[model samples]
Target: MRVSAKSDYALRALIEMAGRTDGHPVSAEELGRQQNIPHGFLQSILADLRRASVVVSQRGQSGGWRMARPASDVSVADVIRAVDGPLVSVYGVRPEAVEYNDSAEVLQHVWIAARRSLRDVFENVSIQQLADGKLPAAVTSRTADEDAWQPH
Candidate 1:
């Protein structure tokens, strides 16, 4: 399944936050500049993230955005869901909600399995681990697979 640009940008912005050294808030403009995401798009993405409690925002001359919790507490899946809803969906419906008959019934299982596989990586990957450049063994193993990097 294709990941939408919203999910991609949210993840990139969060990853940029994960890499911050200073505790000061990061302005949306700076975040967009650093991550190469459009400023307007980043603002919308940040609004969703803030609503989800993934990132906190402040107001004032020195105010901007910062993580609501530590980087280790936030998973990539969390950010994706905040911006894009479910990690996997068939058409616009959730995998489990899709119905089919006879031979096509087995197709639901395929979608379920796809969601499971995606969760195994996205849920387990913390922003801290991403910032440290040390992915979990499961994620590392997948990356190590020669086929994983190949274009479909």
Candidate 2:
């Protein structure tokens, strides 16, 4: 599955917040600079994050955005869902909801397994881990696979 730019920017913006101390706010401009996301796009992404209660916004002189919860408590999947909705889909429908014809009966398991595979990584990875440069063992193991880094 392809991750949308919206999800990508939201993740970056949140990571910017994650990199900061708890309760500290970082402005969109700063986040954009640090994350290499565009300022205007960051604003829209931040708005969605704010609406999702994933990030809190402030007004005035010291105003900026802070994560609503501790970074460690927020998973990458959380940010993805907040911005991108369902993590996996089959022809635009949820994996479980997809119906397959007799000839494609085995496809159901394939879709379910695909979503499960993605969740295994995305759900276990937290923003704090990414911001702190730590990765879950599963992710590390996967990345460490000799061929994982090879461009297919």
The TM-scores of all predictions, comma-separated, are 0.96, 0.92
Supply candidate 1's per-residue lDDT for 73.
Answer: 97
Q: Ten residues in a row with the worst lDDT in model 2? A: 15-24
Give lDDT for model 2.
Answer: 0.85
TM-score of candidate 2 against the unseen true structure: 0.92
lDDT of each: 0.91, 0.85
Compared with the true structure, what per-residue lDDT tens digits does model 1 show for residues 83-121? Answer: 999989888899999999898999999999999999999
lDDT of 2 at 145: 87
The runs of at least 3 residues in candidate 2 whose Cα sits more than 4 Å from the true structure, single-residue gaps closed, are none
Q: Which candidate achieves the best lDDT against the true structure?
A: 1
**Which parts of model 1 are misplaced by more than 4 Å?**
none
